[model samples]
Each structure stands twice: as C-alpha cells, then as structure tokens.
Target: MTAETCENGPLRRFLTVSNKLAALGAIGVSIGFVIVIWVQNNHTRSLLYETELQDSIRMTEVIAAQLYGPLRWRKPSIAQDTYDSMITHRDLHVVAAVTLDRQGNVVTTYQQNSSQPFNFQELRLNAGADLRLDSTWTAELDGKLVVATPVTSHDGRKPAGTFVVAWSLAEIDRAMRAMFLRAAFITIVLFAAFTTLSLAIVHRQLSDPLTQLTQATTRIANGDKTFEIPCTDRRDEVGDMARALVTFRENVALIDRLTAEQQQQTLRLSNALEKEREYNALHREFVSMVSHEFRTPVAIIDGAAQRIERRVGKDTEDQLRERTGKIRSAVVRMIELIDSTLSVSRMEAGTIELEAAECDFAALLREVCQRQQEIAKHHKIDLTIADLPSRILIDAKRMDQVLTNLLSNAVKYAPDAPDIAVKAGTVGRNVVVSVRDRGLGIPEAEMPKLFEKFFRASTSAGIPGTGIGLHLVKHLVELHDGNITVDSTEGKGSTFSVTIPTRYGEADAAASAALSA
Candidate 1:
C-alpha cells in the first residue's frame, strides 16, 4: 500500500463499521435542549409583555378617573394637572386628554410629551359615543402599547372626551434579552453534561452486548448454527435481538430438513400430473366412442319406428301403436343425450359456431314445451310464452337444444312434481326463457359450480345424468351472447333463466306459424 492508503485504512474501517451512537445521542440531546429553551423563553416573554400592557392600561384608567371630575365640570387646570402627573412614569411615553361637546367638537385639549399629533374630532369619530369600556392596544406601534379610554361624568352617564396613553416597551425588551441569554447559557451547559453522561451510560449498557451479538452473527453467517449470543438475560432491545438471532439459527438448521421434504413433494406432484394427463386422454376417448357408437343405433331405432307408423293400418291395435310411439320417444331421448355430449366436445375444442338469424323466441319455446310434455308423459308442462317481436336474432338449433336440456333436467329431477312451468317473455333488449319445477331444489352451495362440466349436486345422487347438460346449455347460450342464471330454494323449487339478445333492428313479422300448432 502507498503512504496515503496506509494512513486512510484505519479511518476507512472506522467509518464503515463504527456505531456512531455517542455522536448521535449528543446531537439529539442538544437539539432537544435548544428547543426546550426556545419555547420557555418565548413563553416567559409573552407573560412579561402581557403584564406590562395590563399595567399600562390600569395607569390610564387611574389618570382618566382623576381627570374625569375636572373635565366634567369644565376645569382645565385640574385635568391638565392629572395628565402631567400620569406622563411622568418611567415607561410612559405620551398621555393626552381632550374634552368634546355635544356636537363632537373639541372644547379643551391637554397633551404631555406626545408621540404623534392628535385630532380630537377624528379620535371621537373613531371611538364613537357607544364605545365599550375596554382598552385597545396595537403591537405594530413600535413596541408601544396604546390605550383609549372614555372620559365621562362621576355617575358614568355622559362622555365628555377620550383619554389615550402610549407606553414604551424598551425596558421590557432589554430584560427579556438578558433573561433569554442566561437561559441559553444554562441550557447549553446542561445539554453538554447530560449528553456526556448519556453516552457513557449507553456505552456501558449496549456496547458489550452488541459486540457479542455481532460475533455470534458472524459465526452464524460462517455456518456455525450452534453459536449463541451472550446477552439473552437483558430485557432491553439488545436482548430481544439476541433471542431473535437464536430463533434464526434454529430456522437455519430446520431449512435443510424442509429442503429434502420439498424435493419429495415435487417428485410426488410430477407423478400426479402424469396420471392426470392419462385420465384426461381416457375421458376424451370415452366421449368420442359414445358419440360415434350411440348415434347409429338411435338412428336405426328411430327409422324403424317411423316406418312402422307410416305402414300401420286403421285396423292396427292401439297397444302396437303405443309401443311404437314409446320406441321413437326413447330413441329421441338417446339422440339428445349423444348430441349434448358432442356439443360439449365441440365447445371444448372451440369449434362450435352460432348461425344468427331472426327467430320468433315465443314460438320456439311453445314448441319446446310441447315436445317436453310429450316426452315426459307422467308430468304436466304449463307454457306461458309471450309473443316476442320477430326482430330477435339467434341460432334456432342451438336455442332448441338449450331449452331441451333444461326441460329434460326438470323432468328427471322432479319426477313426482305434478307440473313444470315454462315461461318466455321479452325483458328490455333481451328475450328470457325460464323453466321452473316444484321439486328437490339444489343446495345453495352447489349453485356456484352448477355449470361446471361433470359437476352434479349432492341432491342428484341416484339421478341418471352425464352432468354435461347444464354446462352445454351455458356454453350454447354464451355462444349467442347470452347468459343463464339459476335460483333455487332447498325444498321449494328451482328456476333456470336464459337471456338471449333480440337482434331485430325493428323487424316485427312472423317467419313461421305458431309453435303450439
């Protein structure tokens, strides 16, 4: 090292590591002492000034009383004598007495050692006849206190003139200056002594504990978790830090065990992710196979039912025709199930599209209600559909499927419910379709996850469902820029509402016959 570097090395180390507690303590105490001294001095000065001002006001009152008898009787000599006597006080600067007549004109004036020219007329005008018996002082008048008092009769009935006094504050200011200097000197001496004592006490109390803590921390940083700070018996902040360091060392030892467990958990999570991927692949394959395999059989059964119905003669037995109708209805239900599964698959793949066209929402709902009544022969379907304007636009096929799923769910869940109500109406710019059933209502907790794929309510235990119906309904409705909401009470009933936008730009004509037909 060079000469300059050698000289600066110790200073550099000290600057980097020295605690500076002594210097900081000295500065804080000094500032606090100065502030206390300043506040006390200001308070003392205010009290002294107020006392002097009050004394001046009292002197004016005494002088005014003496002059009152002379001025009322129009005795100028007695009044002038009182004014001269009052102005002889050491601090008194000017004293003036003036008498005014009924017309407010000055009749007599006496002033001794006057500081400024006095206009009796102006003074009387400003201090009106009804002025209260209180003294007024202005601080901005060059450290002088000014008082205005009314000169009246012995009974204090009629005011003759005004008495004004001006008192100098030079002596008061000089005394305050001396007092402040003495207070400042004493405060400085006390601050120095207290700061030195505080520094010594702080060093005695804190330096050894802090030094031990630093050594313990250094050992911990160098991977010695067994090291302990030697100041745990202290009750102050240093002891608190020492205890915290002990806990930190304990935590450092525990971290190695946690790291090993974390590696095990990570390995387990990786295995679980692989199993989830396998399960998803299997689920997809099952859905695809069900859709492909069920469609052909359902089509074959439906075609056979149709052919039998067409060829049936009037002589055919009612029982045979009923069986054929049942067969066709069962096939239709199976087809609907397969189609719902396929729709969910398409939605997941993001390939489903809505074919928007002007549609009569009321007519479409009436048709869906009729079909549901036929399919659910044991239940009653009450349709309260309103005639919506033809300007509403939607995809007819998707909308039909949406209604079908809701009606099917209602029939399946409320098998013993005597009647289900299907209502359609126009609300603002949207067409709403509601299906309600007085059956086992869904629990409130299940409503949030009601539209999630493959999520069935606890009440749906033993009810046959693929759990894709409501999810599909939600997706199809949203595809047409619509929303669905469900309101259910635990043992009363449940209502599912679907809102679809009415895209009619003022078109109100029917595109087909009534759906009931």
Candidate 2:
C-alpha cells in the first residue's frame, strides 16, 4: 500500500464509498439549484428595471403635458406647484425637476427637501430640429434616473420647452434585494433537506451493511474465530463478503489449532535437545577432570615406587624412606582430589549437612594461615586479625574447606609472588574473612565468571586446577548464609572477601550471648 493508503483512518477505510456517493449527489443538487435561482433572479431583475424605466418615462411625459400650457405662458409658479405636489407623494421617488425654454436655457427649477440650483452648462440637450412631439430621453445621474421630455404647444407644431424630472431607483433596488434573499433561503432549505434525506438512505442501504462486514473482518484479523457474520443470508455483494468471511474464519481457526500443536512439538524438541547437550557437556567435563587431575599423581606415585624398587640394594636406607615418603604424598594428593569430587557430588545431591557449633573465628583463620604457609613453602602467608568476636556459630568443617580452597588458589595462582595475606575481622554483626595475593592479577573481564564451575581465568591457564575450587568455595560460603565479593586489578593483585553472619537465627542467639559473655 502507498503512504496515503496507510494513513487512511476507519472512516476512509469503511465509509468512503457510501459517503462519497451521498456527498457528490448533494453537492450536484445544491449547485444546480443555486444556479437556477441565480439565473431566474437576474432575469426577473432585468425585466423589473426595464418596467421601472418605462414607468419613469411615462410619468415624465404626463408631467410635461401638464406643463405645456404653463411653459407657453411662462408661468413658473404653476409648474413649481406641480413639482412640489409630485415630490410630496413619496413612492414616486421624485427628487427634482427643471423647465427649459426652446433655446435650452433653464426657465425654472424645483427641488424637493434640498436645492441644487440648476446649471445651464451642465444640461446635455439632445433635442433635434425634427424632434417628434412627446419625444423623451433618459440619463442616470448618481443614483437617480433623469428623464427629459419636450413640452409642445397645443397645436403640436412647435417645441415649447424641455421638462426634466429626476426619479430615484433605491426602491427598485430594495425590492430586488428582498426577492434575492427569499430565493436564497428557499434554496438552502431544500438543499439541506434533500442532502440529509439522501445521506440517511445511503447509510441504511450501503454504509450499515459494509460496516458490519468490516467489523467481522477486523475480528478475524484479531484471531477471533467465534464471531458470526450475520449478513450471509442476503443475496447481495455484502452477503457474498459475509460468506467469504465465514470461510476465512474457519481457515484461520484451523491454522491456529495447527500452530498451537506445532508450538508444543517445537517446545518438546527444544527441551530434549537442551538436555542432551547438557549430558554431553557433563560427560566431557568428567572425562577431562579424571584424565588431567588423576594422571599427574598416578605418574608421580608410580615413578616413586619404581625408584624405591631400583634402590633396593644399592641405595642407603634413608633413600628408600625418602622415595616411599614421595609415594605417600602423591597418594594423599590423589585422595584429596577424590574427596573434593565426592564433596561436590554430595553437595549437589543435597546430602551434605552442616554441623553448626560455636567456634573461635580468629583462631580458625590463624590456623588456616599457618597450614597454607607450610603447604606453600616458598610463599609467606601473613595473618592480619582484628579484634573479632570471641565466638560465632559456624559449621567448622565446611569453613575449613572454604578457607583451604581460597588459600590454595592464592598459592597456586600467585606462585612467584612473595606473600599471601589472610585477614579476619568483625564488621557489624558479620565475620569477614579475606585472602589477598600479590600475583598476576585477574583480568577485569574474567572476574564475573570467577566462581562459575569449570571456568578458569586466562591468567590461570598454566596453573593446575580442576576449576571447581572457587566454585565450591562460593557454594560453601552461601550455604552458611554468607556473601562473597572480590576486588582485583590487572598486574597488581586480587582479594577475595567472604562475609558470614554471626548468628544463624534465634536458635543461635542464646548460644551467641553465652559465647560473648
């Protein structure tokens, strides 16, 4: 569709055809009626003006006849009295009159209400030597018509004088204006009545049925299959439209039902595909974990045993003991890996339970610090303990696992760094533990996924890890109803902080009070 079609509203879309037909017919009728009235009015006005002109000339001739005898005797008083009497009859529209001798010089002038003394130079006389008796000429001056008639002698042989009379056409103009107004009023009333009647008929015959069809079409567009089209019974184009709409509705409903079933199938397929992908990923992770983590310890133990067997007779007793010690250490390392994996499984199965007890928070942190220092012989583990609460409710075994993972990560990731700092303090009603290492710091982009399972930072790529240490630590901390946060800058250092509530709930409150006391 074009831009104009898109911009069309409901009235343009639905009512356009019927409305246009009604409007065109009304406008055509109105224009024709106005034209007819205007032409008739103009014709009537022209005829009325002609009649008025003839009447003025006739009146002038009659007055001139009355003045013929008076002008022959040069009696100005009798002509003046006649003019005064005519002006007094207001409907005559007479304004002034003048009498002139045969030489065209004014003999006398008479004016009604006001005087404009006659100027002989202004008189335009067209009388000829062969001018007929009772001959008349007319001219217009301002808004008045001036009629000039010749006064002849009783014998009809000689022109006696000229009689001029001025008649106003204002009355004629007023009558014409009234006639025009009446015609205009009648035309407007008839136009409005006929236009309204035509629109009403058009609305009933065309617009209404079309509107119902449009509504049904809209319902179908909106996915409503239940709305019935009522016009299908009539044998017309609208009925044809209604029947088509019913068919369209049925098709749409069928499509909707098929679409719903297809959607259900699609959802089932998606879920099954996702589950298969997850299973494949878990299998890969299990294989990688076992191969990478177990291979090193197994090889180390095997090599140590082989060396001990080789030194059976040639080496000193100390050498055999040292080789055996190496084998035992490798075995212990493998056992720890197995334990961590088992702990993960138990945690996932929701079978690992916490044994809550009151423990010395600072002492626990110090002991973990000493243990990390021994394990990381090359790196110093510093302890920075503030005045922590004397006791707090905790699951000691789980917390030890949490601290060990964090410290081990520090030593593993920051092997070349000089020291790791383990900090403990009380902030509000919570105990805070932090492990900081001055090593190759984590990248900013890697920080968000630091606690995610099987995810390792790019900086830790060369480091030996199953990638579950921090992930396990996070779960342990959260299981104790705590939160953990990390702050790190690239090439500087990284600090992981854990905050644990001092008391679990009201059950721990009495124990906490006794511990504080």
Candidate 3:
C-alpha cells in the first residue's frame, strides 16, 4: 500500500487594503452628499429672505418720498392712501405712516385692516441708527415685520414724526418654501444618479467576478474537474482575485485527476495484498500437514526396519512382527490424515461438491461419536454423545467432517481429562450440534484465532497439529449456511457448537443411506 502524502494548506485571509478603502469611501461619500445638500438648502433660503427684505426696503423709500413736498405732506391723506392701497394690491399687507414728533414717536400711522401687527416700539427706538433702511423688524409682535423711519416733515423744520410700518412675512416664507422644495428635488435627482452609477460599477467589477468564482467552487465540490473561471480585465483588486481563482481551480483539477488515479491504484494494491495473504496461508498449511502426516509413519517404518535387523534370534521374531504391525497402523493413520487435510483444502478452494440429499443429524452425531470414541481409546479418553432421536435433513458427509474435527481436537488437546461430550438439539428453527471436552482448555487470547487457518492456540504450541482443522470446519459450516462458535476458559474446558437449518422427518432411512459414506 502507498503511504498518503501531505501538502501545505492554503491560508485564506480576509484583511486587505482595497476592501477597507472601499468601505471608507462609501461612508465618506454618503456624509459628503448630505453636507452638500444642507449647504445648498441653507444658501437658497438665505437668498430668498434677503431678496424679500431688499424689496421691502425699496418700497419703504417710495412711501418716504411722498412726504417730501408741502402738497403731499400738508394733505397727506391722498398720497398715504394711494401708496397704502398700492401696497395692499401688491398683496404686501404693508402699513404706511408719518410721525409728527422728533422723539421717533408714532404721531400718525396708516394701516390696512388685513396686515399683520408689527412692533412699532422697537422700530421707533432703532430707526436712526443707520439710514439706508437700517431699521427692519421681524414678526416679534405677532407674525409681522416692522420697518421704521424718522420724518422731518419734508421741510427740514417740522421734526414731524417717525413713520412705523408693519407687513406680513408670508411672501418671504413662501419664497423660502419654494426654494427648499426645488433644492430637495435637485438633491434627490443627483443622489439617484450617483447611486445608479455606483451600483453599476459594483456589479461589473465585484459582483460578476464573485458570482463566477462561487459557481466554479460549487462545480469543483461536485467532482467536476473541468470548471473554468473567466479572467477579469480589471486592474483593481477584483482582477487579482480572478487571476488567483482561475489558477487555483486549474491546480485543483490536476489534483482531482491525480487523486482518482491514486484511489484506483490503492484499490488494486489492496486486492493484490489480500490474495497474497490467502495464498501464503494455504501454502503454509499444506507444508505443515505434509510434515505431520509423514513424520509419524516414517519414524515407525525406520524403527521396524531396524528391529528386524537387530532381531536375528528366535525370541526377537515375535517382537519384529509386532513392530511391523505398529508401522502399518502408523501408515494407515498417515493416509487418513493426509486425505482429510487434502479434502479440507479442496473444499477451501471451492472444489468440494455437496450432494444435498436428505439426512438425519441425530444419526450423524452417533456415527461421529462412535468414531471419536474409537480414536480416543488410543489416547485412553472417553467420548459420549447425548441421547437424541434422528429426525432432520442434512448432508451427512459434510456434517461428519465438522463433528470429527471438533471431537478430534477435544481429545487431542485434553488427553488426561478423558471426558468428551457430543450433543445434538434444536434451537428455534435450527439444529444445534456441540462437542465439549473436559481438557486443557484454550487460552482466552487464542480462542478468537482458533478458526483462522494455520493458527494454533498457545497451549497447543508444542502439540502436533497442522492448525487447519478448525478453520476448515468453520468454512464448511458456513457453506451450509450455518454458524459455529466456541465458549472456552483457560484451565476449565471448551465447547464448540454448530447450528444449521433442520428439515423434519426421514430419520432411520436417511441414517442408513449416509452410513454408506
């Protein structure tokens, strides 16, 4: 397997000068726009008020001119009435008057009934401060303007009176309102134009590039390696980003292709490794089985040959014959063990054929127990099967192998204990078979590896074993759609159980048929 490689990760930073400047510029422009609008509004208001004040002062001078001659001054009613009526017609709401005293007092005054009341007191006191219409009063009395002048009776002799005039500032107010409305409209139009231009610029330079990059990233995440981000011609910050994004996406595409190839390579390597491991296991088991099966017989044959050579006398002939019989038994044992191991291998390699004819498990257990008992007699151990009626469907040959393996192991591992129990029962819809031994039990740590090919328990380290017996048994059980497991304790004992589906009926007849195998 190839080791995974590492790479330096990219650091995405959020802080940048152009972004900061854009934020500051936006705030600055908004504030500046508001200031410009305020100044324009105030200037227009000032112009409107000043023009109205100037117009009022010119009209006041015209009224003062009427008092310059005796004819106009002596009978001042006609001139005063004419000017006052003209002022009224102009919708000025003005008061025209002449004073007959030198103390700037209101001696005689003319007023229209509809004009706003003005403060004559302040106008009389402040009239002579400066002559070019210096005294002008606001609506201090009651929403009115007061204009005052000192009169000398138009003869430079009769310090007649101070003229006091009152007028409404409604026209001045109207002019100011119109100016404000016009300025507001202009300000709104300019802001609208500026906002539209700013939005367009943002859309072209910022939004468009970002949207493209976002789409590219989405495509890349969805396993598309052919995503192409368009480049920007802008020279500002967005252009730098567009260049970086396109380059990064190209690199990611290359990495994606490499990663896919690497994944396939890794899968192939993993499969190759698993096949090699299985091959090694089977080869090792074959070599071990050959060694075990040949060693005992070879030793017996060599002993018999040497005994015949040593037994030249008449008393040694019987011993020589006995040794030859022992060697014959050893040879038969070797042949049986070799055949069993080879059968297991053929089954593992998928060459074993199962003739799934009807059979009985109870009778199968009896035959296996009788065989196990015969084998245990050689080691001075006892084997017994729990009583059960033969009533099931099974492959008798395959089940014999499973039971033989378990019984052989129990007797081999627990030679001194001698007691082995074979059991058969039904659990739910399945037939349950168990072989238990009161022997030198398996260690806790080695129990899980018992069904692994060529794996021997720690206690069986010095024992004669090819170690493929349990593995073959487990595989055979699974091929029958069954399960096998063991419960064991290190100094106590072990029980191996196999469960498979049970078919009802055909006990005695099926047992007789399987007995032929």
Candidate 4:
C-alpha cells in the first residue's frame, strides 16, 4: 500500500460521521450518569448523618429526664443506676454518659467499655463543649457524636443541671463506606449499557436540534431570559421543548416583577410597623403618668377624710397631737408624689436628672416602714439596718418613692403573711436594700417581665394594681446609676434588692477634701 492509503485505512473509518456522532452521544450519557450517581451519593450521606444526629439527641433527652430526680436530690448512686440501666444496651452505641451540676461540676459518669476509655477532655476541647445547660445542643467531632440537654427542675421552670451523652460513629461510617462501594459497582455496570443505548438513539436526526435547545436552556438558566429559543417551528418533540422553554422564561420574568413589587410592599409595611410601635410607647407612657398622678391625690384625700372621721369625738391633747401627726404624714407623701411625677415627666421628655444630696437613709427607711405599717394594719413591717452610712448622697424624694413602693408592694401582696422584712446595709462602697415579702411570689415565667410597664404577673390576678410601680422604680434606680434585681419562687416568697453606689463624683471629692483638711 502507498503512504496516503496506509494513513487513511482504519483511522479514516473510525472517524466517519456516524462514528463521531456515536462518540459524542456516549460522552454525554457518561457525564449525565456520573452526575446522577454523585447526587444520589450525597443525598444518601446527608440522610444518614441527619438520622444519626436526631437519634443521639432523642437518647440524650431521655437520659436527662431519667436522671433529673437523682441529680436534684444529690443521689449519685441513683444517678449511676439510671445511667447504667439506660446506656448498657449495646444497640445504643453509647460510649459514655456524663451529668454536670449547675456549677459545671461533674456529678457522675458512666462508661460502656473501660478498656477503650472515652476522653471527655478531648471532647470538650475539640467539640466546643463548655456545658451550656440552658438548651439542647449537639456536635460531631472526630468520628463521634455528642449530645447535651438540660435537666430541668421538678417544676420545669429552670434547668437544674446538664446531661451529656457520647455516641460512637464507627457503625455509621462503615455503613456509608459500604453504600458508596455498592453505588460505585452498580454505576460501573450500568454505564456501558447506557452509553450503547444513547449512541444508537442520538443520531444526526435529533442531535442538532437537541443541541440547539440545550444551548437555549443553558442561557436561560444563567439568568439571560432574552435569548430566543430555536426549533419551535418544527412539529416534533424538540419543537415542543423549545415552546416550553419560552413559556418558562415568561414565567420567570413575571415572578421577578412580582418579587420586586412584594419587596416594595414589605418595606412600606415595616415602616408602618415602626411608626405604630413608637406611637404605642408614647401612649403607654402618657397613660401611666396620668394614672399615677391621679392615684396619689386620691390616696391623700382618703387619708385626710379617715383622720377627720376618727377624731370626731372630743379628743384629748395626746389624741389631737396624734391626729395632726397623721395628717402631716399624708401631706408629706403627697409632696413626694408630686416630685416623683415631675421626675417621670422629665424622664418622658428625655431630660430626667437625679437630685443626689446628703440624706439620712436609716431615718428614711424607718419613716417608710412606719407609713406602710399604719396602712397595712394587719401586716407587721420589720426593719433592720446594718453598716449603713449615717447620711448618703441620694435623691431623697426619689429614694423615698423607691422605698415606699417596695414597702407598699410587700404589704399589698402578703396580706395573709403578716411579717415583711426590710434589710439595708453597705457592701464595698455600695448600699444594698432588700425588701422581703412572704406573699404570692412571682411565677418563674413572669420574672423576666416583672419590670415591664403595664405587665402584671399571673399571680397578681384579682389584685388591685396597675403594674407600673416596679417599672417606675427600675427607671428611677437606673437614673441613679444603679440596678434592681428580684429573687422569688412561685409559692415561697419574693425579695426585691436595689444596689446603688454610695459615693457620687461630687460626694467623693468632698470627702477627699474633708480628709485632707
């Protein structure tokens, strides 16, 4: 054979038009099959991981519930028994279980296999497990799953401790590897058959039109909706596909327009909501100020009338003196109320200022206790003072309002429980005053909203209150650069404590100067 004929013999036959089309078809089918296999593998892996995670979480929650009683009662032996009973099952794959108290102290731990000990310190460092016992948490670290859940108190009000469980992921990993191998084997077997079928079916008759439609779809998928699809004129499946692409493009454009309009509407709604919130806040403040302003005058008038009615008879000198004293006390409270009302008004105007001055704190407490004691004649007010300065710089009238409201709440809530304790002391340059009442203590759920304006607790049902006292007290205390806290149990009692710095800038300077002289 000549050189030209030798070069064109088998190579030319293989590169014929029919053979070229077959090769292109086989390549396309192979790409499609690989994508399908990859997507299936990923989906299977995700489902397995999610199932294992959910199982770990459910098991941890069960263990926490079972150990609640043992943890709460401080019975480590019972806690161990609970853990062993629940975690000893081999199918559970529980490597270790740990219980931590509220202070993050490890109360008890159970290990499934002591020979292969689980390193909790490694888990803590690698899995970011710092014992956040407020909520349920789960993490995957180094082929292991960790699940932690809060063990709530008996009342289900708060978390008393945390229960943690670790699960071995070896079985899951092995199952995934087996699945992947099976998928690979099946894919290899099916690829040859699929390529042969695609090569036979995709000839010149369909390849050109399908390729054109594919390009048009790719452009549309890339967010170019203006590209005109081809081959719609022919009465064939390719023509039908082209028409469908046109319709899809139109739908996408319509959806885009509608999304833009919806976003505009959402923006308008958000602005309207913000305006409504501002108006509501201003309206509530106005209402609270008006209500308190009216209440003080009414109380003063009632006290004056009561004294007048009681002293109707021919009274002795001592009785006349006592009546006058009671009338003056009522007037003094009325003046204090006016001052507080002005303070609230200033606070609303955003210009509130504290009138801190040297005032006798012990005497003020005694006076407030006396007033409340007389008002709640059925209840006894016990006052205790320790290590308090003789005089501290404070807004005397505002402080009076603070103390009076606390004492009044104590009296009003604890109607049956007669003894209300008021304790005051100095701690590290701060004065702490606490009011304790054996009344219907606030529910745990309602504690967060205790100082919210117009928010009354569930326990305060049928009580004559506006739920503004504590809110106002908090605002006044904050103006003095102080904070207030409440400790209460549902049926036990409540303690409202206020802590304020004893030395203001001016007071500290004056004391320094006095010492220097």
Q: For candidate 4, what is the lDDT?
A: 0.77
Best by lDDT: 2
Per-residue lDDT over 436-476 for candidate 3, one digit per residue giving the tens place of the 0 to 100 score: 88777888888777888777788875568777788888877
lDDT tens digits by residue: candidate 4, 1-517: 1112234578874665555777676667667777887898789878988898888888788778888889889999999888767877435788877788877677888788899877766544333345564445455555677777778865667676778777888888898889878877776667667656655576444666776776777676666777668887878887888888889888978987899999999999999999799768856755775576557656766775777677777677787666666666667656655655566567668786687889888899899889878767689889999879988888987888899989888887877788899999999878999999999999998999898765678887666565667878999888777899999997777999999877644656788999999
| Candidate that beats the other on TM-score, 2 or 3, i.e. the better one | 2
lDDT of 2: 0.78
Count backbone overlaps in model 1.
Answer: 1
Candidate 1 local lDDT, 25-122, one digit each (tens) = 77787788888888988898899988988887787777777767776787777766665565554336454445544445565565554576765554
> What is the TM-score of candidate 2?
0.53
Worst-scoring 10-residue span by lDDT in model 4: 1-10
lDDT of 2 at 512: 88
Off by over 4 Å in 2: 1-199, 208-212, 215-279, 313-325, 360-363, 388-391, 504-517
Q: Write the per-residue lDDT of candidate 2 for residues 279-327, one digit (tens) a residue.
A: 6785577568667888887998899888877777987888877777667
Error of 4 at 288 (Å): 8.9
RMSD of each: 31.0, 13.5, 12.0, 48.7
Q: Against the hidden reference, what TM-scores do the models get?
A: 0.44, 0.53, 0.49, 0.45
- For every model shown, the clashing-pair count is 1, 0, 7, 0
Clash pairs detected, candidate 2:
none
lDDT: the better of candidates 2 and 4? 2
Q: lDDT for every model?
A: 0.74, 0.78, 0.66, 0.77
